[model samples]
Target: MTGSLWRRALAEALGTGLLVTVVVGSGIAAAELSPGDTGLQLLENAFATALGLAVLILMLGPVSGAHFNPVVSAVDCWFGQRHGGGLAVRDLAAYVPAQVLGAIAGAVLANLMFGEQAVSWSTSDRSAGHLWIGETVATAGLILLIFSLARSGRSAAAPAAVGAYIGAAYWFTSSTSFANPAVTIGRAFSDTFAGIAPGSVPGFVVFQVIGAVVGAVLVLVLYPTAGDAADEVVVPHTESGVTS
Candidate 1:
């Protein structure tokens, strides 16, 4: 049990670190690779995010349940995918700090490695407005995909599905699909290429929470049962492969 838990935490930390590296690290890289060509930055981010999520899920699903996003961990509670009573608290505690630190670390490396300066918030214009809508829909779509995949006992496919959706949504949606709140919060701490000003973080988080709640409600409307999520496989001794 001890070893399993350490692995879980380690997986989360490593997963988050990789995510940050992709988000902030690649953003800085993009900025350096092509100055004033933010379009290329977005493109790079989309692909990197997809790759990051896919790798994280496969690498950590067996242990930490591969919840690289705090919002994912939160809504998983509502879907009954994650054990509700106390599991939420513990996962949140671990994921939030891990992600925050990872983002900062990524940002630090980006600055030192790329010589990118701290920049202000991207923009609050139409693009940002579009981004808001994109955020809402992207988050909704992501949760729905997870709910459906889990309901079908195909949770193994979830990482790729989510990664693909997020990557594609980056192109279709008006918002660049900042679907994960923890990532948003962490991004704010860094005024790097991917950074959203501290001012923008709160509004993004609010929308993210609302989107997650909506996702949870949709899960109830669709799956409605724990068994709907998985086959009757024998487990060692915990609900949802996690212990209290």
Candidate 2:
């Protein structure tokens, strides 16, 4: 990777790592604090994740577009190609691995911080047709929302809007909106409140991809010039500029 790509990849790794840390750590804390109250536990986890995600986007969106999710990165690449202004295939290669690695590290760090064993494969089996449907819906909505904001020149609201959307999806979707493949894989490593069973990761990822495709279609239909706004999704940034 080039020097600029390296920096962007590092930002992606660090931002994604920290995002997972907040997710897993808050989940552990929520479970411990709420004990048997699943509702309260979820509330706590959702609140923390929403706020943390917003902050992460604001902080790193200028760098690497804060695309901590592979689905998002892939979609950005696809849309960006239309205008020759989004991430290149090589950037995608660098970004996916970095995001995945960061997510794993974040999960491990959260586990250790909570005095739990690192790398514990989760036992939470989330396999179900309904849950799969939920994943698709969640992901599709996420993709539509982010890209729509860009197309409408409303990228400035992405931080709070994306965060709020995920937070809401957690309650509305049976799958709790694990719309991110990297996050899904990372959460598989922790047998905690936020974890998903390893066996479930593949299904979630597949549905997420399907949802992304659906969402991209929606963007094209709704905003024919959406490709022109490709570099604006999630946030705006350039190779040498402080934009995210």
Candidate 3:
């Protein structure tokens, strides 16, 4: 709220771009480095993603709140508007587009880095019902964790906590926890180890949205005052200063 809208949007773009870059790039690296070893590849990919996400949050959380995901931005907008403080509708408008575009750019960058086609559509189909359930659970857990931190004055732990959760979710969730819509869309642009087929995107996104709604509702029910901390979710950020 303290910075120009453009600046915040720019931050979101850059943060999300970097996040996807880490994910896709690491996946590619894992495949190349650990060929035929699915477990090893996943381990490497999950580790890099976890560390990269935490670092990115710490680096950019003070700007744009480092949302890097449409669901997070939407939740912020909803709670912010309803509770008197959070991302405004205009901010959501800019942030979501920026995040999506950034995600695409990140995927392209990763492909180029790995000597893959710049725009190869993925063929990895993930249409099983279990996968959809995984997405829903992953996304819901993410939302619950984020909002809970804000409500509990534990926003400072988000950088590490979020990263750890995603890393763990990668192994626990059947869908590898593509819990973010932007990231899911971006991954579709590459046919690498991390990519998902274009046809599979809608289902994942829909479930993710459902998960977000469920999570938000749960937060409101469990912590009636959670919205009061909407401005602090992920990390407290402002043009003037930052906390946590």
Candidate 4:
């Protein structure tokens, strides 16, 4: 929270952009490499994403808490306000927009790398009640995992824990666990393996927000604090030693 807003925003943007690049790029590679085997392709994609996410978090968590997801930023801000050591509202404002723009750029980057047209809208329609439910569940679980780690003083385990959870959720959830809204929107710009149709983006985002609320409520129920927990300095900036 003490870092300059510009530096934190840059970290969020770069981290989110790289995250989406890994997702869409891996998906495209997997599809190409494992032509007829859908299961194999999924496995490959999931593995890449898990590994990539873990590394990104480790690299950028010190810079911006590596909150590549808007819901995570929002939740962190809410917790900061309630507990007296979290992201400022203005920071949240900057972070979300940066993440969204980063995601779009990442998608376009992936498409161009894969020899596809840049900025092509996806045609992969994912609209369905069941899919929405799956997204909700996936996102909710993600939020729960993150806040639970913070509450339990186990945030150091976040890189592995979060990566592992998303890998599992990819298979466990029917919608392939597009848990992060920024990533979901980014995928809309690609028409390849990991893309989500533009039309389906809204429903998915709404459900993810609902899921975030559910997760926050769960945190309140599960970890009622006796007093403010000391904020950990996970992300460090040059001027401000505060972490998100």
Q: What are the TM-scores, per candidate, against the unseen true structure? A: 0.79, 0.98, 0.97, 0.93
Q: Encode model 2's per-residue lDDT on 58-146: one tens digit a residue.
A: 99888778889999999899988888877899999999999999999999999999999988999999999999999999999999999
* Candidate 4 residue pairs that clash: 62-235
Q: Name the lDDT of candidate 1.
A: 0.65
lDDT of each: 0.65, 0.93, 0.91, 0.85
Model 2 error, position 67 (Å)? 0.9
TM-score, cand. 1: 0.79
Q: Mark the 10 consecutive residues where model 3 has the least summed lDDT.
A: 235-244
The better-scoring model by TM-score among 3 and 4 is 3
- How many backbone collisions does model 1 have? 1
Instruction: Give candidate 2 regions above 4 Å deviation.
Output: none
Tens digits of per-residue lDDT, candidate 4, 66-119, equal 889999888878877887867778888999999999999999999999999999
Q: Give residue 52's error in model 4 in angstroms.
A: 0.3
Worst 10 residues of 2 by lDDT: 235-244
lDDT of 3 by residue, 133-206 (tens): 99999999999999999999999999999999999999999999999999999999999999999999999999
Ranking by lDDT: 2, 3, 4, 1
What's the TM for model 3?
A: 0.97
Each prediction's total of clashing residue pairs, residues at least 3 apart in sequence or on different chains, is 1, 3, 0, 1
Cα-based lDDT at residue 79, candidate 1: 43
